[model samples]
Target chain A: MSESYEATVTDPVSAPMTCDSNPVEEWLRMDRMPHIWCPGCGIGTSVNCFTRAIEESSLDRKNIAIVSGIGCTGRVAGYLLLDSFHTTHGRALPFATGLKLASPKTKVVVYSGDGDLFAIGGNHFIHAARRNLDMTVLCVNNFNYGMTGGQVAPTTPEFAIASTTPYGSVERPFNLPYLAQSCGAVYVARWTVYHVKQLQRSIREALEKPGFTFIEMVAPCPTLFVRRNRLGDGLAALESYEENAVIKNGADTRECDLGMGGPIVCGKFVDIDRPSYLSNQVAHLRKVLGDRYVMPDAWQGVVQ
Target chain B: MNADPRGVLTGSHFLDGDHAAAEGALAAGANFSAGYPITPSTEVVERLAGRFPFTGGTFIQMEDELAASIAIQGAVWGGSKALTVTSGPGFSLMMEHLGYGIMTETPFVLVDVQRGGPSTGLPTMPAQADMMQARWGSHGDYEIIALAPSSPQECFNLMIRAFNLSEKYRTPVLLMMDECVGHMLERVVIPSPEKIQIEPRRYTRKGPDEQYWPYSLEECNNGDLVPPLTKVGEGHFPHITGLTHDDRGYPAMNAKSQAVLLGRLVDKIRNNADDIITIEEDGTDDADVIVVSYGITARVCQPAISRARAEGHKVGFLRLVTVWPFPEKRIRELAGRVSAFVVPEMNLGQIVREVERCSQGRPKVRGVTHAGGAVHDPEEIYNAIREVMG
Candidate 1:
């Protein structure tokens, strides 16, 4: 690694010190200039969408927690001007799960990769969804492993060739919307990078959704997926998405399918109200910590 | 001196290791215990459920370990001493959040009742494979404190100590117990709550409406490395994520930012080892042979020590109560005195390397290990002790 690469990797943004930058942009560390994304990764788009969503959501910036796992997509949390956590690989869901459960008032969002979510963190994803925990998960599905060179992931197409598989990938990719819906997620959607407006709207909706909400953003990995498949440049992938994609008008997961991209289903898929884990927990806490909670004066003498 | 000090403790019955752990957390002023049940460790949750409600503390059986671990931290930030308990599988599930706890400097106690596993290896049986993972499982380089207790009594006592250490250092403290110790029916006495010295992390109350930094380390009266905590609902401080952060709890990724954040996380624990690490050395001063063990394995080694001494061997015992601060200084001193050190454990030689490192090539340190459900036979340790004497 050159001094520049080492410097880039180490110099992370904290406490948005960039001047005249939007207050939100001020939250970003400017010294950590030039992130480690490929020239045209869609994660930057999603990061922009997320920043816009947070700005539009009108929640206190300090009260929001953004957690990310390893991958090119994981870097979104690093640049955000919120209480963000950049956790280890494949563990972002659990970390965000903890953050959400620990403080119910805080809006916890997991900005992660397809490999980290579907491959390594599948168990956590299913469980978090099944329990209908209120959280926002933005899964950037670039269709390849961007961090460790382009390799076939659980979200990769059935016959995509990459560094790991000399031949095309034999395994079928996960239909994430269906998986999340089956796992009892109350909100689920799939959107490609070409539809940045729709992606941003889905994220905003997911943020306000009262239960587990999952958004699968079909991002282009120019270095891995494009280079391996010999697909044209990022513009080609974005153009392909714009040409082939079909948007579902209503919030229905059954209308979405990744294998056959009919009605690419980019809306709030599930929005039925369900009891969240924290609300129930707070009720339980209120029941348990009854009189002491009512009479804060009692705690003063007791601590002394 | 009378050899038998078995009755030194004020004994209480029906208080197994799990009950002891829960009661100890309660006594230490823990106001919340969020847990999901797994074998051997379930009793901790069961007991907390029955007790927490009455004491004005919250006890929640979450949907899973993932939720329970976070719920514990949340309750802690909500102005309570919070805790969670689980077995090996659940502990593995909780490791990511545990790393979050380290990065965010969250104070909570995680009781991992060890069960066998590479993956669901032995849900019902005991193994100490997680000993290494407890410290190094997470991706980043940071320090955490873990304590191992042999008896139900120590389970109660050490849990209180674990909570205190967690509060003092502002990091997660792990109470590592195995199935043999966790599920064992043992007599452990609960000390009177007044008798227990409860130390809480300082809360920053300079002004209720002032800007509060939840992660800023305030020098306590004792010069300890703990920040003043402000709970969310209390309307004081802001809490942030697992990112390497600054004093104000905002995320930072710069090299210098990481250096300062990582240094604080490590230095807090490293600088406080003298106040943290606890061990027990028996007959070590004049003995040529010694047996090292902890948790239930130490119980087995205790009788082995007595039997070996009766058989005219100069055998001693070094039982680790606090394992994470590693007890390097004490082990080094023991290595200079003993001819050979025998480490008999329930897991395959987890702590023996520490014994070896401490021995510094002076004494022969041998590991005697078993990974199954059964406790180590007293005679096996007795034999190892004698062999070391030779």
Candidate 2:
């Protein structure tokens, strides 16, 4: 055979493209692929950033466990190649809280969506932060509930059209960063799908923090949020985020609220040190019991 | 297997049922518990909170019952033997997660210190009304093992059994305690660790190099139908979900997968009913009338049974220890010979329906129903037995 013909047959560059060549493929359940995400949905992009963050973090893959509640983002747990749990709707924070307490050496991440984390699971989110549980919560905020059609969510900005609020929502939306910071989260950040590098960096930083860390990634629900509000397609939504998002690290979280068709504030808002729930518990018990206090079996080597 | 000695108190003490249940959990080698404070059941967690620090156990007071229920499951996945305690209102809130546990085949114990309720009817009062709720509250066709403890001693004894059955079957086991039993003080003897047998969690023996499926029946080696569990950091990379899943524990939302998954979940408990069901019988060999009772009512029926026996009636007594597998075989066998069954319980007619169904019209079943707050009078139960034999 001629040299050109041999090169065409033998070169990897001329081979048919497969997902096996993708770097993130190792972190995902490729067997379960053909993911359920809809066309132009931004959740897949956020997940890509998450896989990159996991790769960059110093934590061992075997020592990391991901938990998710019922929503479109909840499916992230099932797709990840790790010890993952798809828990009951609105219970991911508490589930991860228990996992962290039981295996203090394991890095537990609660990956869920706006409605699953804020509406039904709102109480757990607030309490987990208030207690300063050692876990990271990555909330993919698409504004409305995307999994169950575009229903009005707690994070849905006022005057945005949703299936449950076809006449337009009148209730004010929750400012998530402000909520997390006020509830005693040691690390809080916000970014959009368009800001992939920043989002991945924020996730890595949050993973290294001890106490409860919250990161809100504002993504697009083109089939619902964008289409219903006439905000164009997913690409248009990313362009809008690129055009309007302001990066102001250390900005007061109270001023970080998002309104309908308004500028999106994106940056780290809170980073501080606080004793986590388990550490506080151990410290208090050791003080009271003195030599009688024995570290829990799971925390024997990890604590102290 | 023997329990861990650190968890065993190993002494005799006058304790309430709730406290004894806590000691029982410790003796069973439960290293983690998450619970919320509710009426009557609060003492169980209160005792655990006071003792867990010393025994190398972790007890968390979650925000609500829903959180507590799911938190224990997370701990189980993280390689801790875990449990959660609550009362009627809180137990209702935990129904969804109970179904989640059953769907995932997660082994954990739930202690429901029963109080009167459709919705918080009587918080501090005695009631056996939640018995049916414990069996059927979760919305699914699944079987769960539920045990009723009649005294503080039984509370300590049965909790260990509850944990063992849960691990053996890989299902949630309910420790059903009424307000009376939860609050009643009695002498409880806690055996030494060597004397107490504990079934360790059936963790998969497969190494990281081998493929391990979370729900694969092919991995079942003990002939019990339960697939061994895998811990989070074990490198099994198991995917556990509440959705109907295939043997690999991945969501298989189709009719065939649902049938296989739900069928196994139900059959694991039902098929093992012979080994799982426990009942106490007296004078049942030759009797014209049998009185059925459980929980506090079982103790109440004792005096009534003695009164009927004194009157020369061939009255037999049956006390249910494991209420859920319902002791159907024994009840049916006795029903073929007995003329009637007198069931005196605190509820309107919960387990009596089971007795009636099991008898299959072979015997007349009478339910001596009381609507909470107090135990049945021995005279009332005696009269029911007399009426059945009159």
Candidate 3:
């Protein structure tokens, strides 16, 4: 654990909006709280957005499943009252991918963090998107590891101060939106806690969208990223988000080149058509296993 | 060998362990398999993919090990018996969901054709190193049923038992085949469908789904344990999680729920050990020396056992078919009768420790260890048996 530094920090507090509209409170694991997040962290915003999205869609609460990996943000599934899975770090994607495939009728959503998604689970993420497996992936990009004292991660901004990079981070961060789009996310979006209405809207669209849908929520890590950048308290980080974020159209992913000077583009990036993995699998199985199948109701036990 | 007079299955032919495993799963009524190709165990998937379709079942090559595991779970949930095959690397990737299957009590079969490992240690080589990992790798305290096949035909027969135990207990059943049995090609007699007894999944037929609780436990007059399970769309249950949960499947985070759930999950197997565990002993009744072996190593010790006994030495063989929920009582019985127990395995003395643990000082147990792709020479085992006789 790191020492708590005194804040000569004068971070402005954004006006409090209604943050407590959790529709699935009865379904959540309340005792695991207060979640291991820094005070004023935006992961709570993403979790609220997820619960709100699920509520708004009006999907069967019982059929809905939430799978998460190891990280502060990944623990969102633990607190939610759904069929939640807190699996091994960086493994939630594959686990979720499997869960969705096994029970395709069930609504499967993966909630993880940048490190969980883009670092350890990077291969599974890209491949799942490529395969277009039917699932929603909500990645909370907090730029650094919050659970382990804010270490540098794949999404940590360059030249930023983190536990591992005390001098300054020289490694470049991944452009998650562009990478996901190129890998074939039928629906892709990026939003910050700063954009509640827009974030909620993107989430709703993703839920309705077919195939692999990815939403990268740029949450604030006030205890780490913001504290070190002297960016102010967690609430101030959202205020700065409002000031600096450029929410362009989804097509802006093509124009925002990383390694070159350009604003980070955040919006609903891609929505398109593709036959999902499970549907195609079902079609193939139906065709091949047609004559052999005994309909469920009429099935006479296994063939001798 | 001649066909059985009952006409249930053709007699054994010269076949390898891999072929036996595939035919075993087929006989056990495995109709769906979704797995990615991996070494040693790849043949299991390849054979299943070809046979399942012809048998009127589904076979899918999942994107990865993780997806394969989930797909198998789904097939089982869809009311189809399914299985997946993988080795060390793939198995490592599947540890988390393997735990998921255990927690959900989803019945499925996983064939781990053991290979050398830490990372990608030795893929083609033989190793029984995953024995402990198979039981404990998936987090949480839960009982699992694992079987080791000592011969090509045993692989075929044990796989059938694996599925049955998986279905009855509602737990993931592991068929631990080392690279030796996994890669070695041997002919196996295909059992006629008439001879195979297939147990269809037990679904609740209660009226109106509300009365159904998917995980409700039931104890019969004879005190047999059964956990309630219903199909997904059926009105039987609510939520299921990796977390400690109540009977309703809803997440329950109290000690009371944890104690109850964990106990039931484990007790369901422990209480029914007689029905779940199986082993074979050759000349163990009055032997002064015994050889405890399983899977491929047991094959090497087979000839040695016969030779030791032929040489006027009271040497015997104890072959474990059920590796976990281990044949504890039977091992104890053998300990009392035998003077020494010799364990031959293709790994660094893994199951030998189990033999020592089960012997309880009644018999001196020693390990015959080997690693890498090579199997132990029969002569080595023969020598070990002789030394014990002296």
Candidate 4:
């Protein structure tokens, strides 16, 4: 329905590495190739940035988990070459919460979408943040629910046309960074899929934090959200980021509500510290129960 | 294996069924539980919270049953035996994650204390009505192991078996306790750590870098009915999904994928139903009437069955300990000889249907139904037996 500037980009011809030597190939399920993401869709771009970020992060590939809920972004887990859990709709946080509390060592990341994260799963998002659970939450905000065909979402901007809101969305949208920050997330950041380097760096930084941290990448649903709302193609949407993106490092999150095609305030804001759920549980139980409390030993289930 | 000594009470005590279930979980080496308080099931958490401090276990009061159910699955993959308990309304809230546990083959215990309900019908009363829901509540084609306990002592004893089955088969084993038994007071004996045998989780033998197939139905040397699983953090890098998955644990949606994954999910319990099912049968060999019952209803039917036998009416009792994998094969084989089956349950006829289906119309199947606030009267069961005998 729409077209944007196509990249005249090409990879430089170089010595090709075999599958065993290539980290990207090693970390991806090649059998599930030709991903479902439409051409020029921003989710694939976001995933590419994530893989690059994984390559850069200090965590081992085997110790990181990618958990997702039901949505387009939810498919992120199946494509990755890590231990992932594709759980029920809006239930990813609680599932990831269990995994983190049980293992206490895996770097758990929830990669989901706007509708899945802030809509049906809103309660879990706030509670997980309030508990300061030790995990990373990455939400790819495409302005609407992309999987079920562009329905109006909790994060859908005011007056935006969606399948449910044929006239336009009358409800004011939630500024996810503000919500996560207010709910006690230790770190909060926002970027676009177009800002690949910045997004990857922010993800790496969030992964390093020991308590609840959240990163929002504003992506484009060129197939549905863009075509339905007349918002141009995904590349044009990316270019819109180039034109309207403002690097506001410490802007008040209260003023960060995104518009249909307005200035996007992006940066790492609200980076602080708090004791995670397990750390506090361990400390409090030791003090109260004392000698009676047996420290949990993670020895028995470790595979050779 | 013996229980961790700290968790074992190693003495006889008068505890309610709910409390016995909690103690039994700890004695069976359950190190984690996530639960939300609901009627008839709250005492399980009440007991666990008080006892977990000394037992090296963790009990978290989750936000809701949805969180509680899925949270235990996390604990299972985190490297501990785990469980969650709830009542009817909360149990309904857990069906989705219940399916998740079945699909992912995660081993965790879910104890549903039966309160009467289509919707909060009897919050504080007993019902064996959830008997069908336990077997068919989750959406999809799958089978699960569900056990019903008639007395507080069996609640303690069977709670251990529940966890053992969860580990042995890598599935969510349902401890389907009803309100009557949950609140019922009886003497429960806690065995010493050495005398108690607990099945440790069947962990993966594959090395960290080895290709650990989470759902491979292939044969290991020991011939485990279920595949062993590795901890999420132990460098397995395995992927788990509720979708119909292949051997590698990746979601593959197709006819072939469904057949491979769902076929095993149902067969893992069905193929081993012989080991999973336990029942108490008496005089069924030569009885004209067999009274089929479970949970507190089974206990209620006992005196009635005994009185019928005393009068020389040729009555017998068939008590179900594992209500699901519903002893159909045995019932089918017995139908040829017995004149009738008298099924007395708290709910208005749930398990009776299973009995009817398996009977193949060989003998008359009579349902002695109740609305479920209270247990069936002894005379009611006795009358059903006499009528069936006539």
Q: For all the predictions, what are the DockQ values?
A: 0.16, 0.72, 0.19, 0.67
The candidate, 1 or 4, that scores higher on TM-score is 4
TM-score of chain B of each: 0.92, 0.99, 0.92, 0.98
Off by over 4 Å in 3: A1-39, A58-63, A79-81, A254-264, A279-304, B1-16, B26-32, B54-82, B92-106, B116-122, B125-129, B135-143, B185-187, B190-195, B198-268
TM-score of each: 0.78, 0.97, 0.83, 0.95
**TM-score result, candidate 4:** 0.95
Query: Which candidate wins on TM-score?
Result: 2
Name the candidate that leads on DockQ: 2
Judged by DockQ cut-offs, the docking class of candidate 3 is incorrect
The order of the candidates by lDDT, greatest first, is 2, 4, 3, 1
lDDT against the true structure, per candidate, is 0.75, 0.92, 0.75, 0.86
Cα lDDT of model 2 by residue, B165-192, tens digit: 9999999999999999999999999988
Candidate 3 per-residue C-alpha lDDT over A77-118 given as tens digits, one digit per residue, 9 for 90 to 100: 767766566666676766665555445666778889999888
TM-score (C-alpha) between model 3 and the true structure? 0.83
Could you report the Cα RMSD, in angstroms, for every candidate shown? 7.1, 5.5, 5.6, 3.4
Weakest 10 consecutive residues, lDDT, candidate 2 chain B?
Answer: B216-225
Residue B206 lDDT in candidate 3:
67
On TM-score, the stronger of 1 and 3 is 3
lDDT for model 2 comes to: 0.92
Q: What's the lDDT of the predicted structure labeled candidate 3? A: 0.75
